[model samples]
Target: MNELFTRIVSGVIYAAAIILALWSGKLATNILFIIFGLICLFELQNLLNFKNYVSYFVFPIALIFFNYFNVNDEITFLFIIACLFVKLLLLRDLFSLKGRNAFRQKKHLITLMYIVPSMVFLTLIPKLYPDYNTYILLYVFILMWINDSFAFLIGKHFGKQKLFAKISPKKTVEGFLAGFTFTIIGGILISYFNQTLSFYNWVVVGILVSVFGNLGDLVQSKFKRKALVKDSGKIMPGHGGVFDRMDSIIFSSTFVFGFLFVINHVS
Candidate 1:
């Protein structure tokens, strides 16, 4: 009973904050996400048992550069490539059944490649889109939320086949399909009201969030399994921590941002 209440309260608060930030304007959006990124970093460091104080100094400096500077496509592409490489390493580590020492050894690399770049891309989404189009960033969050919510509901009731039993035993293929289906419905609705992005683009966004967002969740679960911990932190009553809550967005936002980049610049 208490757990159920906690979940409801936390969900309401989280949803409110996200919606408020999205509607408030660009500065609010940027500041909210930046704070979120920092908290996620702190949680990630703790989860991995990394204790480097230098990250405190380096994160802001790097964010300032990426946020303020006129970074070109070449540099952005390089960052993406680095992020992908780190992602591969993370996947390898997740499945290896190795000891925690591997993560400890590569702590700095993970911080630099995985944590930093994901946050950077998340922060960039609002800035990269035109002023009128910042809502597109909000749309990404909405889709992710919808995907998560439906996945949980459908999975809880009907899930049978484990999606990734080793990493996340609770997840099911049925839940994944339900999430994807609802995300498409949500995307179509958003397109109807906004029209900032074409219906096709919105459909693409739905696919990215449904697929990659779930991947993000599994990846975080893998990290927790490696650490042999249940939740990342106890910051929220029901939600584990900033890292736990933001994992999906952290993973999927980069891909969504990449799509936006291609649409706005390359194509």
Candidate 2:
């Protein structure tokens, strides 16, 4: 009961902070992410046991360049492509037997290419449409939170068949489906209220969030398993670390940004 209370309090505070930042406007959101990105890097650095000091610089630089400045669409597209490629590679590594070994070899590259850009793209999501609407980003986080909450609750009570016992023993197939189903529902509801995206697009976003968000959590679990650590950090009382909390969003942001971009520009 005490542990559950701690989780609820900490989760509420964390969500409040993010909502405040989003409502505060672009600079606040960017600053919040920079701090978050740095903390995530620090946590991952400990996990990977890499001593490269330069890894810290990659995130702020890339984030400021890609976001603060008005870079051409061509350049932005190329950068997004690079980040997507590395993200897919990370996804592929998750399924391989030698995943840890592969991650160990490319720790610095992963930091630069994967971890940094993912967070950067998250900030860009709200700006995908004309004018910077915080509601879009807020809704994204809400969907993720819903998915996560349902996954945990349903997994703990009704879970039977393990989704991946090796990496995350607690996760189950039932939980995953529950999270996905509810996320689509969340997307529909948000679409009616927000009008940022049509019902169909929001549903697509919900599917992306549910699928990739779970994969993100699994990937982070894989990282922790490789590091032999139970949690990323003790920053949040109940929630492991900033990385632990943001893992799903961080991993899924790029894909969400890409989809938004295509809808905004191509469609």
Clashes of each: 0, 0
For this target, which candidate reaches the highest lDDT against the unseen true structure? 2
lDDT of 2 by residue, 1-267 (tens): 999999999999999999999999988999999999999998988888876678678778888887778888888688789988887877888887763455778887787777788888898887776777888999999999999999999989999999999889999999999999999999999999988799999999999999999999998998899899999999998999999999999889888888888888877
- The runs of at least 3 residues in candidate 1 whose Cα sits more than 4 Å from the true structure, single-residue gaps closed, are 95-104
In model 2, where is the ten-residue run with the lowest total lDDT? 96-105
TM-scores for candidates 1 onward, in order: 0.92, 0.97
lDDT of 2: 0.88
Give the Cα error of residue 71 in candidate 1, in Å. Answer: 2.1
Clashes of 1: 0
Query: In candidate 1, which residue pairs get closer than 3 Å at backbone N, Cα or C atoms, i.e. clash?
Result: none
**Candidate 1: global Cα-lDDT?**
0.82
lDDT of each: 0.82, 0.88
